[model samples]
Target: MTDFIKKLEKEFDTQIIRSNKHIWENYYDVDNDGNITTLYLDEIDLRDIDILLPIAHSLVNLAVLDCNIRTLITLKSFTRLEVLSLRQNNLYGSPLEHLSYLKKLKKLDLRGTNLTDTSSLGTLNSLEMLFIGGNDHLDEIKGLEDLKSLYHLDVSNSCINSIENICANENIRILNLKGTNLKKITHLEKFPNLESLNLDGTLVEKIEGLETSKNLKELFISTWRIKRIEGLENLTKLEVLDLYLNEISKIEGLDNLTNLKWLSLNSNKIAKVENLENLTNLELLLLEANEPITYFDTAFFHNLVSECYIYMRDMIDIEEIQAAAPKNVKINYDDDYRWPTSLYRAPREVFE
Candidate 1:
């Protein structure tokens, strides 16, 4: 009960709301324009803000500990707020109940919580990044249809059975649906704009509607079974393709994808190098964990062969790279950005 907080109490007492002792530790300051603003605090704990129902609108930036706060009561008062992260909290009750008031907000991280219903999400249309993943209890997510501005939608491991209804959202460039029991996906026609589609551990055996998705760049399709590269010949915009553990291996139809910079074909059975003779833009090629790659002659791939990366930390030598490269051309190899795990072992060959 400090003199300053006492003065704040007389001006803000909605049903005798009490202030937590944690609020006193915050350092308050005023700007040149006389607008009151709290710059920083050693610790951020907002379990006691209900007392000042009127000042909630003044909290332009509030980031609380994910544990202490369960359900936000007067969050709508944060009309001036922009950035908020409620990660690692219970977040019970109507998940989108209190956040609708933050119209000026930019980002919202509700990852790994018990938020079941996401029906009120469309109201916050200005949001750019929506991290609503790891909520196993969540079964319904219908309100995102109006989020025409959302760039990233990470609904990974959220128990979502069907997102066929949400396919029309064109603004989403990155859509991650990893580790779900989804066996089939229909009508990707709705998302003619999807750049990155990750179906790593699902039962998607075939890629059906991707003939129209020319903008698709990075594609991670592992687990389950995809036997052929039949439908993706027209994917000229493809940059990275990760087909780690599958059966069929003739990648002929993909010759049209000249923009392909990275290719990952590990843990499969492929005898030939296919028709990549025209893929001059290729940079990094991951062909480990498949059949014995000790046979790919480097001279065949020298036209565009930059750096041949095999089994995560190792680079195929110039002689080894020249096995797949052209004899007339010569280039250095550098294993830059890395994938931590690969079905193939690094030391089996060479690592530097």
Candidate 2:
């Protein structure tokens, strides 16, 4: 390691001299030239931020999570930082414009912070993925239109009431609005490149405004007020569809979803499983907790899961459903498993 890193470690060694604290080497990632590339410190009360000035010039990723940090003025020295995560901090009154100097930053994760303003984000022109979820005080986001290159945006579990300002992010590919104040789904045509959309834990009743999301692949809307399955005829590229814990009665309007791979409709009011014979690519099907479902299309299971696997965890009537399932289809069960979006899905490939 370089002398600067040695001095940096020495300072950290003196600062956190307790036996329970780890050394500075364990909290940083170094390159071949002995330059610290990434530094991660969690749950450590960072009273002095100047201790990290030694490696700031070479650091590319920095995470000071849950450290009770109250300012961002010291991070301006990390000129090469590309990814920064200040999750679970107390930056309620910090100056967000100080981060605009990070010209190389691409992804910024600020989840579970007390930030209330985002008007200075427009200056970070290189940002591609912005995560500001779990900020209950952040009711609105500004400068979304200035983020021309932004493709992934997550504002779940916030106090935002409308999407009028969000409609300007025309390049967003994956938009997550779960557990927000959105009452209805609208302006979907504004995002022609949207792929994955989540509206779980909202008050949306009707499944409209999605006629133009033709390239959408994964859609999640659970535990809401949807009663019927409609407005899904144009999504030919759809692969995974989850609509659990709703009030859906009958299964219909799914003729164009021939490429569907996974379908989840648990805890609904459906009486029969029909109209799924065309989903030949389906590998996993979930129909648990639907108390009214009595009839199961044997032909659909014979053609769909006969050559694949399925998850039958906590199924309503496992014995009967297993009896009706094909013998070649393997059924796996889990007692306490939940979907990734139960809270909010991180920015990753949902299918894999």
Candidate 3:
């Protein structure tokens, strides 16, 4: 055995396997005092690490760190970290001051950390994805204007009322502000590359200020107080739209979205399914949990092409509608077989 391997075993107080038998075996090293440190560790699983041990500062190549602990004071030295997850930690009162020096960070997950202020994260210019959701007390994110390279940002279930700080980032594509106190949104024209936006469970009463986001493809505004479906005629590139659990009594302003594929207006006050004949690309239409439909429009069913799935309430006469509908359009009334209740359900590839 080499003298360096002996010293590592003595420092880490563990047996040393010097041979590079596995791909991951060569990246880890143990110190003489049972402290693991490595220069080649790209991803570190700190979930099972002893909290008493000093954080490994020597892992210069560490790219990912999964540390969901009570405090992250020791992680300030990980200057080369690209992805740092402090999810579900008991953090409080702006603990991100410790991570202000990590300039190369691209992804940071602080979900469920109970963080109050995130002013310290604005300096991370290279961040691409940031997940700060589930921090119920986090009301402000005013310092995120400098993140010019950000792409995806999720602040769901936070107390934020406005998103004016990061709206100017043209590189951002997906923005999630669900379960927030947002009432109005402006400066959407600055995000010319934004494709997917989520405002579910927010307090937004109007759907204006999005006339310039023509690049938007997927939009979710479920469980809000929006009564009308106007102000969306400019989104010709939209493919998936979810307005479930709203106060919409009629369906309108969707004729421009010729590329719409998946649309959900479930749990609303809609009584008619009109204005959908122009949606030639629609495949899945969800209208479940709405007022009972006493009037049947067979022409509406004929507008949908073959293999289209329409999910509605069980009270609708399926046999009568099927007799008049096209042979290929599948009308489903089974509540159990319908799409998942949540509009923001993860993509199907997550389980596969």
In lDDT terms, which candidate is top? Answer: 2
Model 2 per-residue lDDT tens digits across residues 1-352: 3565456557545232212223442366677776777666667666545667878888887777787788788878887988888888988878888898899988898888887878788888888888888998988887768788889888888887776656346888988888898887887888899999998887788888888899999898884599999999999999888888799989898888998887888777877778887888887677666665566666777666346555544345767777877767666555575533232345552111
Return the TM-score for each candidate structure.
Answer: 0.72, 0.85, 0.76
Model 3 pairs whose backbones collide: 10-32, 11-31, 11-32, 11-33, 11-34, 12-31, 12-34
Best by TM-score: 2
Worst 10 residues of 1 by lDDT: 343-352
Q: Judged by lDDT against the true structure, how good is candidate 3?
A: 0.70
Model 1 earns a TM-score of 0.72
Clashes of 2: 0
What tens digits encode model 3's per-residue C-alpha lDDT throughout 1-352? 1454455446545454532222333234444654444322212333433332244453322322333354556666676566555566566754677777787777777878787777777888888888888988878766776788888878889888887644336777988888888888777876788899999988888788888899999999985588999899899999889998889988899888889988998888888777788887888888888887655566756666556877787446768887776766887776567464545654221001
Q: State the C-alpha lDDT per candidate.
A: 0.61, 0.76, 0.70
Count of residue pairs whose backbone atoms collide, per candidate: 16, 0, 7
Ranking by lDDT: 2, 3, 1
C-alpha root-mean-square deviation, each candidate: 9.1, 4.6, 6.8
Any residue pairs clashing in model 2, and if so which?
Answer: none
- Residue-pair clashes, model 1: 16
Lowest summed lDDT across 10 adjacent residues in model 2 is found at 14-23
Model 3 deviation from the true structure expressed as Cα RMSD, one decimal place: 6.8
* Runs off by more than 4 Å, candidate 2: 1-26, 302-306, 313-328, 332-345, 348-352
* Model 3's TM-score against the true structure: 0.76
Poorly placed runs, candidate 1 (over 4 Å) = 1-65, 248-250, 297-300, 305-352
